[model samples]
Target: MNGADVIDIARDAVYTLLIVSGPTMAIGLGVGLLIALFQALTQIQEMTLTFVPKIIAIFLALVLFMPMMGAQMGDLMARLMDRVATGG
Candidate 1:
């Protein structure tokens, strides 16, 4: 493939990756930020306090968004396979 083709493929992969991972990441970030604010306000300096809630929130988000993630991944894979098939 040429530079344009490589760039297009990389762009698509990045797009698909972001689409697949964005929900869980956003959830984790939001939760973590809230927890940080709470900790700051409460002056609770417990190191492990921040992780559990963020992880749980991210897990829940992943579970909720699993179908969409799967579809995005599947579409990206199908596109790649088609490109390979057609020698794109």
Candidate 2:
């Protein structure tokens, strides 16, 4: 592929990655910030307190967003395959 074609593919790949990761990351970030605030307020500075809820939320988010993420990845892969087929 030429430089412009490669740049296009790279841009699409990054966009796909962001789409797939956005939900889970947002969940994790929200949960972690909440937990941190709670810890600061309550003085319950246990490490597990910090990690457990955020992890759970992230996992839940992953479960909920899995189908959408998969579809995005599949679309990117199909586009890549098409580029390969046509010698982009």
Candidate 3:
């Protein structure tokens, strides 16, 4: 592939990664922030408190957004395959 084609593919890959991961990451961030706030307010500064809730929230986010993530990934893969097949 030419430099432009390579750059396009790299851009798409990064975009696809962000799209697939954004929801879970956002959930984790939100949950972590809330847990931190709760700890600050309640003085319950247990490390596990933050970890468990963030994990659960991220898991839930993944479950909820799995279909959209899958579709996005599949679309990206198809586009990549097309590019490969056509010699970019």
Which candidate should be chosen as best, given lDDT against the real structure?
1
lDDT of 2 by residue, 5-51 (tens): 98999899999999999888888888888988999999998988877
lDDT of 1 by residue, 1-88 (tens): 9999999999999999898988888888899889999999999989999889988888889889999999999999999999999999
Write down the lDDT of every candidate, Cα atoms only. Answer: 0.92, 0.89, 0.91
| lDDT (10s digit) by residue, model 3, range 25-61 | 9889888888899999999978788878887888889
lDDT of 2 at 20: 93
RMSD of 3: 0.8
In model 1, the worst 10-residue window by lDDT is: 54-63
- The per-prediction CA RMSD against the true structure, in angstroms, equals 0.8, 0.9, 0.8
Error of 3 at 78 (Å): 0.3
Report how far residue 47 has shifted in candidate 2, in Å: 2.1
Candidate 1 vs candidate 2: the lDDT winner is 1
2 or 3, which is superior by lDDT?
A: 3
Residue 23 in model 1: lDDT: 82
Candidate 2: where is the Cα deviation over 4 Å? none
